[model samples]
Target: MKKFWLLIVFVSILFSCSDNNTSNKNPYIPSYSVNLSIDMNLPAYSNLKFVSNGIIIPNYGAKGVIIFNAGSGYTAFDAACPNQALTSCTAMTINGINAVCSCDKTEYSLFTGLGGKEYPLKQYRVEVIGTVIHVYN
Candidate 1:
């Protein structure tokens, strides 16, 4: 009877265990360390001052980095589309607070990073110091 109870306990423990394995993952893209800063006072970056607006900085990351000024604060994300193939056209362009991928027209919200795509947009870190905005990964 003791062995039977031990076996039952072992079976119960086994049944209670849960597996956390998840196969739904984003595309495999190499992570590159990003460190960039922009002056919001500049004419080119002045558009970032308003909510639901963003600007793309060239020559950074796989494609570039999109900086957005959300209503709460600011956010930065990789310009590369997370759902599509990595190509020049896979880069995202700013349309209000949404980042639109030119390849498949996948639009991701700049504020929440969610959209109709399979995954959310790849995001970076944002730090604001006066008129200067620093974006990094």
Candidate 2:
């Protein structure tokens, strides 16, 4: 019957339109074969306040960010916004003790490595063995 075909068509369309929600896929984190060390007393370290290479590093295990301080220390974190993961703009800019992402202007505290405005920046583990900094996934 025409009504039966119409019903089937409507059901098919509804199922097709249903959100194909996929699980959050982990990002990739590059490996460093050589160990690197930076001196905090160096002029280059003291001169530059912030650095941006316009590159995004995936965490592999989860969404995160990594900040390397040649002079002082190294930091890593999850790039996903703590408040909400709906937006793709979770990357943040470091401003002293805070990291602010241009998208939504979400501010995260670098000191505590937590998100502000009811969200916190998920932090990763960092090991400083002398001048060498190790960031692991």
Candidate 3:
């Protein structure tokens, strides 16, 4: 009876194990301090108040931070292209809800942050509640 209980506990622990997002944690994307919040209802952020749209908020992240309203919620990404060394041209431009890297002409999906590129844009944490959109690294 004791052996049976021990086996059950071991099995439970094994099934409860979880994996981390190591793939998304890229080493190439330089880490910089970031902590910004914007009210989506505000006139300045009105462009981002709608779904399937993105905006670049200056003075944040390595290049800049691009935030998008992807229908579900908001997502933040580093504007620097993850494919190569960071440069001026590597800075991404907002095209609808996609981020285009002029350096290699690669585009990353603003919604999922993964498309038309080997490496996805470095993403940051985003929290939306009420009318506030918080982005942090």
Candidate 4:
């Protein structure tokens, strides 16, 4: 009886576990390998030291990568507009804490990666080591 109960418990616990991995990838943007490190102390990246500020690093991801300082931590997203295909105007330009797409004037928030359209901005992983910010996918 004891052995049967143990087996039942083991089976129940095993069945309870699940893979909860979620991805914020948009279908329009191509997945690119990203492993960039930005030093906040550097003159070029100094603006990132303040909260709610972001910068676009060209020639990195689909169009590029936009790194944002989201107060509590940092976030990085693909510069390509999530709502549309890759075109000359697909690359978004930053407007304060938001990234605006010229194609349809769709606006996306840098802090949350949410946009007005169906697809949200594809997000990358971010890590901060002291003053240096590391972005990867």
Candidate 5:
């Protein structure tokens, strides 16, 4: 009858909407883990830019590029922005002491690794051993 068809249509619409909502949800958490002693040497990092291969290390939290500077005896951060998840632009560009997410122009402080009035970038733990740099979750 007409009522039965209407009920089926309503159910179908409900399920479709639910599916769309679930698909749009951001379920990714960026993290990574790298052995500093073996992967990166601290002395070599000084005053130079060291970039990691696009490796998704789970302990670090999400997919991102790790940039290290040895000149200032400092390391920078670019925790992939969760806001720009679906695109190929997963890496953040470093502008002096800031990490800029190119997708939406979200800027994060490289010194603090905190987002500016936007979404916060997940920071990984950094450990230095002698001349080695280690990045982890």
Candidate 6:
């Protein structure tokens, strides 16, 4: 009886496993480790204190990263356009609450990071502790 239960559990575990790489792969942007800390008290990062505002910090990700204030919390995303390969014009620029790709003119919302056709912006994890905002992969 114990052997039968073990076999059933093994089969269930095998069936429940999924090939996550095949489904969630984004072939455009190269992966980079992002460990950034932004102080809201600083003059350069003070703009992030308000909702619907975003700031682009260079020398971080594939094409730097854009940190946005989404009212409820903060969010960060790779500035590279996810629709195509990294090119001269692939770096996105902040326009209000959206990040616009100069290459294909694709507009990605900073609020939800949704834009383009299939893949959305590669978002990093954001955590706000007091006045310090921690952004990481």
Q: Tell me how far the alpha carbon of residue 69 in candidate 4 is from the true structure, in angstroms, after superposition.
A: 0.7
Whichever of 2 and 4 has more TM-score, that candidate is: 4
Name the regions of candidate 4 deviating beyond 4 angstroms. 1-23
Sorted on TM-score, best first, the list reads: 4, 6, 3, 1, 5, 2
Candidate 2 Cα outliers beyond 4 Å, as residue runs: 1-64, 68-74
1-109 per-residue lDDT for model 2 (tens digits): 9996566455434432434322112232222222224343455443323432111245332344544442233454555555555355645556654667666776664
lDDT to native, each model: 0.72, 0.44, 0.74, 0.78, 0.46, 0.77
What global local distance difference test value does model 2 have? 0.44
Ranking, lDDT, top scorer first: 4, 6, 3, 1, 5, 2
The parts of candidate 6 lying over 4 Å away from their true place are 1-24
Cα lDDT tens digits, model 1, 1-137, are 99965664453333223131121234634577789989989999988888668888977877888887765567777788877777547578888768898888878877656677577677776778999999876
Best-matching candidate per TM-score: 4
Per residue, candidate 3 scores C-alpha lDDT tens digits across 1-137 of 99965664453233223232442466667778889999978888998877777888877988889988766567788888787777546578988757888787777777667766567778787877789988875
| Candidate 6 residue-wise lDDT, 43-136, digit = tens | 9999888877889999998899899887666778889888778866657999987899888888987766667578878777777899999887
Q: TM-scores for all candidates? A: 0.76, 0.46, 0.78, 0.81, 0.52, 0.80
Candidate 5's C-alpha runs over 4 A off are 1-44, 48-61, 67-78, 86-88
Residue 115, model 3: Cα distance from true site in angstroms = 2.4
- Winning candidate number (lDDT): 4
Candidate 1 residues lying further than 4 Å off, grouped into runs, are 1-25
Q: Give the TM-score of candidate 5.
A: 0.52
Model 2 scores worst on lDDT over the 10 consecutive residues at 21-30
Q: Candidate 5, residues 23-118: lDDT per residue as tens digits? A: 113344433443333244334334343422222222233545444442333333435664566355666666665667767787764534446544
